[model samples]
Target: MNITPKWWHDAVVYQIYPRSYCDSNNDGMGDLRGIISKLDYLKTLGVNVIWLSPVYQSPMDDNGYDISDYQDIAPMFGTMADMDELLAEAKQRDIRIIMDLVVNHTSDEHPWFKEARKSKDNPYRDYYIWRQPNEDGGVPDEMGSVFGGTAWEFDEQTGEYFLHIFSKRQPDLNWENPKVQEEVHKMMNWWIDKGIGGFRLDVIDLIGKEIDKKITGNGPRLHTLIQEMNRATFGDKDVLTVGETWDATPEIAKLYSNPARDEFSMVFQFEHISLTWQHGDKWSPIPLDLPALKRVLTKWQVELADEGWNSLFWNNHDLPRIVSKYGCEGEYRVPSAKMLATTLHMMKGTPYVFQGEEIGMTNVAFPSIDDYRDIETLNFYKVRTENGVSPEDQLAAIHVNSRDNARTPMQWDDSANGGFSDAQPWINVNPNYTHINVAQALDDPNSIFYHYQHLIALRKAMPVIVYGSFEPVFEDHPAVFGYVRANDDVRVLVLSNFTRESVTVDLPESLQAEQVECLISNYTAPSTLAQTVTLQPYESFAVVLPA
Candidate 1:
């Protein structure tokens, strides 16, 4: 049975956005108790690991990403006791809990930042990056923040400036300080001692910032910092670690996840995820190029084959839903969702299912800007409009690319507020939740949820799905995305149609008319293998070819 204990290698992870997952107290926000209520449901969905978004004490300025305290649970989410209860309950269900670790920056209100800003001579002053203004008395550098405006925030009381790679409320931490590193490592160990599974380190690669704030990420000391972190925390423990890496090349990624280095188990790279936008501008919306996306995916798969590992995902809290963005969401929603699940799950990596993804829940189109809560969306609207872009154009871009699209409340059933709460949710639920929800999906055997369940089971049962070689097939095909995954004794061929029109896939001459097993398919396959196979719209089929 090849029963090794590396559960993360083939396990399916589910991500939960706390404020939107469920509201047990009817306070219009999801809490730890809310998550506890959904544990049985998540277990039914066939996921072994749950990656919860930040529930730490925060000022709610970036939706909990701006943390004022790393060890305490935000009062809005629940109490520290609530978090412990959640961990105990999840462990009983055989599911591991992964917490979000946002160490790159802390909310301006954090005690460390407050103490550091008291005066340059304070013991905590070196904990954060602070620079004196230039000769012109302007900010240290003209570097732009991830949200908008300059990355340097002027401190009037201190007569200097502090760097914030994201929102001004989030000041970047100075990793060069040994005290800072020791504190972070101590906090990580505290969580491990609490019986928590592991962590999802947010924007971890950006910690190694260079001297000039303008040049961000993948700095000179990135690897050293990561290795030091591993040695101090998760290296000897049975814990899972995945770093959120932005703009990281394959070469840089290998260093983070290579087992020999003892850094991380994998990394979440954005190359394939950013194919729909211009490299530097999120406001420039464009159609996704399938060929380009294929090239990026193939590159990562091949490059990380012998070393490191890949964290596969199509949707998360930061991006729009995959179905509405990359697949047809109206008429072919179910088929397209199933097809995407097959393609991602069949690859040699851990698959993540964002909440509502299994039920084919889609993106929302809020009528106006006032309906949105994401800071990035609102910032883009203001910045682009001031840059001469029309209000209509800016809203159009936000509709297509806003992070809020994925932050809507989970669709539980056809009830007031999608059965998520008795009161209105903090964020609006997609109106389509009436027809697309977990209750409705459970009623129908042929649903996106069941298909996902089957796919997860298939991945768990097949060793080749986790350790086999990956080779792209029909790379030049316009509508069909096909690939071959094989080991010494087994070869699995997967064929998926990306478009809503019929397409044909051609097989290699060596395998024509060979005996095969129909392992999985969204639709019934042809009687036997042949030189050519015609696929229906959104059809996805996988078979084991003869040796």
Candidate 2:
């Protein structure tokens, strides 16, 4: 908590999903050299850390999340030597690399799992969560895996069922076993020895959750396990471990950030991101709770500002693109995307950039449910269909909220395959490349890329954004969320209009200056009058205070 690592606290992390980021070889999948090719682009954007999704040796299940070999890169992604080159190149640019740590589970094909399944008495059997089948020889009851069916999959040879919180190919590790914990540490240290930074622990909250029962929705076990793992793996080594805790409450999330807890540097909670579903169930029709989101984030800010940092993100590889999710999707896409970015990055948290997010990439459409390859999205479709929802309706639901929305190939430019691949890409790139791509965005001064680059640079230069105390300014104002971030004499007021109508932001007479200048904005006007700031529909701006 005592100014741990200044770089990670305010660092900009750009996520590179290995398969879709860029492919140097003509094999049609992205590789490490491909990332090396773009180091200058990342350096130009002012990001200091690159968070790459799983490139470990794996079976194709869940993309690369299902690791079959912890120590090797998937041949499709490149070799160990290639990773070394990537680390060297990134280091030269002052960009540290953080790979995904998927130790919570491994591919069924993983040597550990293979040995475990071969015999119940194998030394590696305890590496996974294994249980006996029910009296009826059926898998034990549970809500089901995030992918589909029971969370348990049967192994005929071992005559036992193994828990798979995710896809069948991904078996959960038994962290309760000290030896398992040791092996995980060994793997983590292996990466550390490779000169890479730490990890963006995948589903780390769920990692701690117990295997005694299937999750009814979300439970407490996730919290406890992550703490134990952090103690074993990080333990004051100045590791940048961020747990992925979806559905974790603000109060519970604080525990991970509590310096006394030995949990993690930060944890990702799902309050702001969930606001988009506004009508989905546990997986669908949910309603947006803007006021609740404001309150939740505020609570975290108040509680953990000094003790821990927050992992602020708007998009990731496993969710719908932010532009179509929270921003005005139909007519006001550009303005709203910029506003949403303003609303998010301006807050008191470390910002994470998903691939192609700066250029306002959008959701890609799958012609049908089968066209969707993501396990969670496909599982949701099957569940809704079995619940008597029509196929058309089910597909309609996935179209809007599926995790597949975020997995499309990165659109680089107007090349034959969006410049991602000369050969066929694993997934189709969003066809909006003509309107949205790095090549075009970089050429235009007013493009989202320009805005994001400025945002990242400002964050690096200003301590107020990184170390300032946050206070929500207009909490009670309708369709408006405003906050003031200040550190000593440096003060900045960030105001955003979340609605489609212009809103008035009232400033206290004492705090209001005679005239204010727009430090940054997406609108045509350079600066508006300070007395009565007129925020256009979905407009946002950063105002440098008169200190």
Candidate 3:
């Protein structure tokens, strides 16, 4: 398959979870104005695009994911004027802003949902999925919510159960309704016209769910709906569209991202992240299998090398911090963080740097459940406790897997609230912020921030980083992740040690070169690549050789 060059192919994205990013007004939440105030900072960080989490009108259920109004900004996040200012300011810095499009569901407080529940014959009834209860007065199906509990919510007024695959407060939108699709498209076009970049669709795969058939993702009409969506908005424009699809395999990804399909620029697949999920249960944690992780990542790299695109990321608002989950958060935090960045950024994908990730933020272990704010975390606690799980075990799992671990406020300085807000924050800031902050990172030449800056610049300078074909090296190595990216001009050999102990590996004769250019390394640069090389704890580097 022939690849078409696009701007985002070489671009790096920075994701900001709005409420915790920066609180400019001391309102205990980050707003559009706060984001605008940091445009220069983001510009300095070298990210080409900013993928802002949901800032639309919401009741704060699910933070901002359960949107109530599609066109208006939430009061907590500021007004439409603030959003316009952010877009304008980011554009000035050559940074494109992509808002999260959460069409999978809407806050139950939304006008459509409110009216839909008023009476069965309401005109807007079809805007959301509704079904009558079974003969036993039970739910429409045996489906469970992603957060917990039943996916169907009973409405007394309408005498029907509305489908909500997430929080009961978030009713799933009916994509089968042409009017809903039109409304979503119209709203997207409104943002595009405002000069916004594109969209990072939220749980987009669930939009075409066949509820009656118990199919939630990769449904029969999933691609058809996405293609129609592309035609309706951002299809002709030079905009990036990435769909959040937990069920996406290489085959399914091709249907969604292959250029000829006109669906999405790429899809965020969870195969790599799901490696630690034991028996598909996130709360049931297991040791990170380094070899298994390499296999999963290599599969995606090789499978999507030609037709589809990839979204490279380790941390997001919905997942635990990378350093905490996959690296050392203690003594080796700096090197491990840089090592993780070097490994992921060198892959062929549009890499995303979550807020605080550039400076090596780790997961927060809040003492009690009362300190947690994420709906998913709270729900899991309640459900598991009721199921006779010990509170101690649950808290241990929460420390490692809770979404709230990533929702902590950004640590800017050592001052109060980590300089995120003057007053108490909506959630507790990580206590380690005193040392792990932007201020300290800026002062240190060997900080993780500088490492990321160099990596981003490297991506922009080397076409091989973006367009090179990937081939796995040391596929059977226990603790080493090795790969080679090659094109006509150069072959870049990237290697990382995913362990706390020093490991040595022999280089293949094919990868050996007479002359090598050290592109980037987390540790001191070696003079040359010897046949047998020893990598220190969490060490990673990339070197260029003749293709």
Candidate 4:
């Protein structure tokens, strides 16, 4: 963008799931040292930021999300010295590091929670949410955890239930308590002073819940709490903050991300990604409603353009791979991935590239349930089976929608453990890694990796790609999606075929042939415009149009 460098506004963030990125110690788990070993690779990808998933000390109950110690590095990921070295190395390459901040809850193993459960009179009891059992000795509220069952966990010693919206090991923190907020702020400031760039707040919106009403998000004091958080911790620093607001509407998102307010630089909204699920349930798969997806995204693009900003992503540690969910992973894997990247990268926001996304990683179908490691997936399997869902059916759902799908180790080459580790990986590497690995992509000029490099380069070279206003085109079309982004000097048209079948669109008469200049495309086509144009399966093209 022509605007002064606000780093976050124009930067591409590459997310690394520490357990799956690479294993430097041959322990089969990715670590801070593994990330340090790949700094040059990130530099080559042209991404200016790296968002590492939680490396904080944890019990691994919910992977790294259950933080036992926010200040200490998790032994599985490596030492604090390793993290310091990683930060220095990344900075040397002009890449900023954004850490995953899981403050909504802490592991029960945390000193605060450990003491809180000892007795009702314990000094640390107020650090967590504990409630007396209901009249019927049931949960204190009607809310269900995101992982299923009641959101309340009964602690035998205290004879009170603690709220955990995730796993029981992860008890929600009492943000209403000033002491808790102070502890969170102190920890954040310590990280900032340690030279960390920013934070990706985990389940940030859920932190402000009303116990009586059982509302998990957009609670009464959510905005006030975030505002105070900013003023206390990150307000003075030049840092990036992104909150994971799973159920946030556009209006709610604006509140968290508006620049006028000292909350966050942007928020990750889940509306578009949740389109294919029935009744907002990830396990319930249905046909993807393309028009609805476009509508939700367009609303965010329009509503957040002025006051707030958006965090663009298709895959993350908690979701399935992009190609498997939205694109054809079997026959049209390469082109489909490039198409997905072009669509998201060309949007009006900061784009995030999840680990292995650039090289076209696809989801895995582990032959048996034992192959899965994610607690969420395993929990779903147990619950679904008890509810009479057939084993085959449960496996089908997990294969298509498990978070583990995105947790597979990064495939660097075709060698053993996909060159990720000399030992067997914590999770099996996708067998397709032999062909879809980064080494193969680097050697092949037309690989998805190169396409992503081109896309990142275009964002850096063209200001319009970063600052242009977005307007949806062919909003009602099912198989083909199109949009235009324009600035004072240039307007760019992005068109993609979302299906494996050829699709055609009637070009608007306003798009003159003389003004069209090809910028990027997954497949070669004539630059000249026609009244109607056909797109091959999974083809995507972007062109500079007359402004």
Candidate 5:
């Protein structure tokens, strides 16, 4: 059953936010050499693929997402030789490398943009989206940047406005231009030719904008354009390409990830990540909904049952730490984190591990907004501050949910700079490293790190959790969250108590197996009402029964 055709189906992809992972040169920044040094660590985590964030030559306008050059590594990361060494080292460790492909935009400092912005009549002018100002001398659409400010920025040199969905320093590339498309394909092939097996496409859905019609938001163009990419550089390459697509409907997700669709292998969706935000803006919300979380997972469960693949995860570079955002990381940190891991990975899809996630890293609580560095976080703070927003409350909310929440230097150990750097880190290491470092978690058998190892091993050992169809077992029950995954020879029953009080999970008529083996359990709630079993607070159980 060691099939290679479907390696991705059974693969574990670990996402490494390079700047925060490790720094080897004492430059206060993580580099390719640092990643090379940690291949063995990633290998020990049981992940087969490493999805690295952008490492291309850039101005770091958006943390390398705004690529200035597609062909080489940024000076901060290392030279091209260093990248090759890291790639070879990772491959030697049996880990495939997935580079982040930020094709939607290029750095404004890019030679192409520099030349293009010289004049509207330049050959490279059409390489980006440039439009004549409207009758009112304003940008045509009231398009909003995900970061902040107007999506269109006026360029005095060109006497035209250029579109930037992100930072003004990053201009959206015109995918409709054949030359632009060809250049991107060539760049992608160069990476693949350099031995990369896959790509984690950044803002990939934003490619192929509708000409003449201004793109207001996430629409169908995201899908139809990806079709072009799959057809071009990645055609029949036996590779992986995931899109950072938010607000895509379930049907759209299938269209993007369906094997036959030829769009992408999988894409990152943002629906589940929104649960942590419950207030003014989705970013710094006040409340979280656990029951609604189960509902979100349920939709994906049915949406991708036999059609598409889901990228299962809790934390990544964009959102706050999983430990802080999801489960009550303070009160029931151990069981809650453990149960949350069990809750997601055991579902039907490929599991993506964020860096430092295996060690249960939580979000940081900054004493002042001055400590924050993320552009998105700063934009929100500045705008709210200018609007007469309370400086104290804004800083408090930011402490709860800043992108820097996930960007703090990784805690490798309790040593200097959390063992992540020989020099001062670009960002301060979380002060709780003494209590939550990898060294401490790995040493404790019942720690969150160990729980992740158990879940990963079980997923690889049992296809019922990997390839089996996902069916929510106790869907109608409010307190009980359970599911069943049945492969040919195995039926895995996963039941969790998401509530503070114990809840009973009744046995299904088809679940006739009287005996159940407890693969893992954090707590136990009684099921005396149905004469079956109950689960304890924040506890999760994985039982193997007869098919």
Candidate 6:
């Protein structure tokens, strides 16, 4: 395989969860106008691409992930006109907007699903995965939904059970149906024609599932369908397509991302993020294993160096804030946040900065279960409480692991609701927003926002940052993470102290260079490289060395 340069190869993407980004209207929910107002802010942040979460017409069952209309914008989020203006504004700023594609499932309220549930013989009935009841007249299978409860939902009118890997309201599409595949391809092309940047395909791997065989993801026909979808849709266009495949292994990712495969530009593999999930259970939280995290990330960086691509990210709309997860949110918040950003942004991939992450956003701990809005959090609360888990214990876990932690309103200033909205926000704003906000970060030169801006600038200026080969450094160090990126012209060494204490590591002779210059750091770096150096608590720095 040969490397082909793509526009997105050097671009930095910023993700905006519109519902929490900003609210121009006092309707308590974010709208398209809200995002339009922030276009300047995003531009100032130096991001080239904006990954907008789903805004399609929906029942809001899963916060727009369950789509009812693929072609229309949700009324609560504004009209199609508002969307057009946003696209125009973003394009004018040289920032491409990539919309979320959630074709794995559609809202139960969708016209197709509504008609399909009406009768077994409905033409759209086959659009979804439906199976007859077993001999005992029970569900078709024992599979369970990702949001809890049985995966199969029985339809009284059709006398059949439909597979729903997520919430029941989100019925999975039957990709095996050629008609369904055709409709998906058509929808994708429609979006492409609209001049949108690309797509962040949600749970795309699940589309090729073999329900009867209990294969939920990375199924046998997954690559086949993806290749066909690519050829029929955006393959010929200069657009980025990243599939959300939680089950993608490094080898499998190659099939999805290798240019010859004619599939996606990349896939968001969760191997590194899953390190914090104890025994593969999300609710069972554990401390961030720095060594394991390093190993996983290093593996992806090395394995995908030749044929595939990688999407580097820490927190998104569905995970806890990184400053609060892997870094301390207390005294070392600023430096730690910068450290995390430095570590990820310097890697060999397209780095994504989630909304509010550049401002050092921390996780929120709502006082009560009623305060939470995520279906997954609420379901887990009820189930755990019923299963002998105390409310306090569950809430404790929710503090560290709930998806709601990342959904709080963006902290724009010290004003009420963090200046996100004039009226009450749909969700509570983080109380600490008064101190940690975009306004404060903008005023301070040493803020995390500036750090991110600098990193984005570096990527655009330095070819080595975008195409360098990754080599692990201090791989066994428990409290320190370090890596070297090298190309024919330059070698860059990035190091971060993960713990809240000073750590000293000896430089390997192979990595030692006579000529070294500090490229960027959270702290004032030394003038020259040494055989050994000490890193302060939560400190991170990148240095350019002779190749």
lDDT of 1 by residue, 1-547 (tens): 2323477998899999999999999989999999999999989989999999999999999999999998999998999999999999999999999999999999999999999999989999999999999999998877889999888899988999999999999999999999999999999999999988899999998888885645568888888999999999989998889999988889988888888877999899999888888865767878877777788888898898878888899999999899998888999998999999888899988899999999998989898889999999999889889999998888888888899989999999999999988998898999998999999999998899999998899998998889899999888777888888999989888888988999876788855655678777888864478898888889997888878
Q: Which ten residues in a row have the lowest lDDT in candidate 4?
A: 1-10
Give per-residue CA lDDT, model 6, range 430-493, as digits (tens).
Answer: 9999999999999999899999999999999999999989999899899999998989888889
Please identify which of the two predictions, 1 or 2, would achieve the higher lDDT against the true structure.
1
Worst 10 residues of 1 by lDDT: 1-10
Pull out the clashing pairs in model 3: none
Please state the error at residue 272 of candidate 6 in Å.
0.9
Of candidates 6 and 1, the better by TM-score: 6
Using lDDT as the measure, the top candidate is 3
Q: Return whichever of 1 and 4 wins on lDDT.
A: 4
Model 5, 1-547: lDDT tens digits are 2223377877888999999998989899999999998888777778889998999999887888888999988999999999999889988888899998888889998999999999878999999998889999999678878887788999999789998989999998987788988898888888888888799988776784674566534554666667777788887797888888876668878888887877888778888787666643754575666577778889987887777788898888888887777666677878878888888888988899898888888889878777777888889888888988788888887877788988999898889889988888877888988888888987888888878888888878877777787778777677667888787887777887776676766586776465666677676422222337667777887777754
Determine which window of 10 residues in candidate 3 has minimal summed lDDT.
Answer: 508-517
Q: By TM-score, how accurate is candidate 4?
A: 0.98
> Local distance difference test, per candidate?
0.89, 0.79, 0.93, 0.90, 0.81, 0.92
Off by over 4 Å in 5: 1-5, 211-221, 509-513, 523-532
Looking at model 6, report the run of 10 residues with the lowest lDDT sum: 508-517
Q: In model 2, how many backbone clashes occur?
A: 15
Superposed model 3: Cα runs more than 4 Å off: none
Best-to-worst lDDT order = 3, 6, 4, 1, 5, 2
Q: What is the lDDT of residue 303 in candidate 6?
A: 95
Of candidate 5, the 10-residue stretch with the lowest lDDT total is 523-532
- Colliding pairs, model 6: none
